[model samples]
Target: MSSELLHDSGLIANPASTATLSDADADSLIAELALRGRAAQRVLAGMGEQVKADALRHAAAALRAAAPRVLAENARDLDKGRANGLAPAMLDRLKLDDARLDSIASALEAVANLPDPVGQVIDQRTVPTGLELSRVRVPIGLIGIIYESRPNVTADAAALCLRSGNAVLLRGGTEAVHSNHAIHAALVAGLEQAGVPADVVQLLPTQDRAAVGGMLRAAGLIDMIVPRGGKGLVARVQADARVPVLAHLDGICHTYVHSAADPVMARSVTLNAKMRRTGICGAMETLLIDASFPEASSVVAGLIDAGCELRGDARAQAIDPRIGKASAEDWDTEYLDSILSVAVVDGPEAALAHIARHSSGHTDAIITGDAAAAERFLTEVDSAIVMVNASTQFADGGEFGLGAEIGIATGRLHARGPVALEGLTTYKWQVRGTGQARA
Candidate 1:
């Protein structure tokens, strides 16, 4: 189906005034999308696992078939972004090639292959009153996702939500509007082919910022809001959204090299943690070394040699004259680039102290061979994900074997870490009783 047909079919709102939309118009559009989404979610909830899996597999095939068109749309966005002087990192996230399209499709297929999370019995037992009580997973109903750049999120978020039996409403950034529309069309075509409701996944058809406010204020319609973008976007959604939010905040992650860490292992893991696709949220932003560790210089030298710009505290700077001075703010910054902040700590306690002060509670890693120190670090760090003897870059949904993620949630409430199919679901109690009375 064409993007226009999808818009007209009520899968998406009609393209609104891009320049400005009155509060009433924006509210009407948001309401229309939400109503459609709720209806779609009801249909999706009734679908069996096989039916949903077939739809995802069909969507994967459609994405592969529509690769050329998707790439073309992405190119147009890239050109405009360049003209608008988007940063290199932002452009990297915005740009999509054939390989990325293929990966997105593959991720959808992977999600289909995983066992469906909906309807799964979490726990069941018989109460003393002869009441059978059980909790079964269910969809969160209509989910509103507001993201920036990374057009692939259109497909990933849709696939995860559909597989988990929830409807999704996507609001992608203006930078990738064309790409998002193109991808959404392909997904809708797949849904149609599989005999599923196309409205199961819809994109807001306008780029006006007001659309976001509408989604945020959609209270009863949008069950939850997942913001996948920069700190500013996440902050706005968290601050203004009336709906519950699954926030993806800054990845000011830290990699601490304890005194027991192997020098070679530390060098290898640190390089990959910082330089392996530095634009991703899993990338390590800060490096901590125990002052008692004798091999800190080797690891520092390896990073500098690998073309990673190092901004270090006074002690770290004293370790290497070539290391640039890092301000207090640098420790808290998420430089989604080739830059890294370095610090030297007294020991595991000091490292923990530093991380507690500056870490974003996203992902923090400790590289140590000492079992006790590793355990201590793991227990002490309050981040959603903490790694011991592993690179912080492994903090990913796909790497964690959950297929693809909507985003890595930093919040400690209902869900944390990589939000995959299971994260999309909430549970409800089912009580069965022949005869029961409250005494």
Candidate 2:
């Protein structure tokens, strides 16, 4: 009933179209979103696995049916991004084509096929006094997701949240707002047809700066916030949120080449990690080579030959002047682009030392044939996901057999890895106690 609602109502005339949802209307919409989420979550939690599967199946169908419209909306975003001078890397992430739309729908189908994470009873036992204690997986209630300019994320996040029996609040970057909303329209249509609450998969109607502030601090409305963007946005949300956050602060990842590393595999994996998708969170930002490795020089040379612009410190720059001189900042940067920083370490100890000093604890990979060295790297890396002879990009949950992920959680406590279905829920202890009085 606010001025904002009138404004938003005007924008909704073209149901298939997307426009900025005003701030004045956002609070009321969010309130409705939270209420609907709570209700939908309750029903979903009680839903038979078959029913949930059916919903996912229908959602996939709806996504496929709406692909053309999704692509059209995405083009609008891409055109706007180009006009606004968005970086190529960012635009790549923002753009969505038919192939990407199909992939997003395929992911939903995959989620429909994965084992349901809900109704999973971890431990159940009866005590001597006839008290039954059971630990069961349950939905996390309501989830709030804030992500950057990836339109597929709109569908992926919503599907993952819904399948896990959690209601989701999605706030994507302003740049992809149009694409995100269009995709959400399909999601809502699927949910409604499946008899699920449209609010269960709500998108923020407004693109206001203050809306994020409000969502971050909506302690009662949101159960937790999942931030899936750059360090600045994640840090800002973390600082502002009263609600707990499942976050991947930064992917300042690395690939360390040991003395025993196979140069060819290391080079190929490193190239793919950095150049295949430079703007993704899992892209390797730093390349570390053992000082003692004879092929280390060749590996660095190979990277430079493969079109990587490497920056290094004095010791590293002395080896190759064609590579730029890396400053202290290079060691700590998450370039998220074509740029990569290089460092030379004496051995595994030095590699671990450097990683410990500079890693953001997102993803780190080691290339080594030696089992002992690989084991040491895996054990000592101290990241949410560690890899051996693989690109850090493999850290994604989908590659790890998770149908999809809300985001990768780099936090050390409770949730430290991929925010998949299991991560979307928490455990509850169901207790039934006999009549036993305290003495």
- Give every collision pair in model 2: 21-205, 21-206, 312-326
TM-score, cand. 1 vs. native: 0.96
State the number of backbone clashes in model 2: 3
lDDT for each candidate structure = 0.91, 0.83
Top model number, lDDT: 1
In candidate 2, how many Å is residue 143 off? 0.6
Q: What shift in Å separates residue 310 of candidate 2 from its native position after superposition?
A: 0.6
Query: lDDT by residue for model 2 over 11-82, one digit each (tens)?
Result: 344433344455544556666667777887777777778777777778888888998888888888899899
Per-candidate TM-score against the hidden true structure: 0.96, 0.94
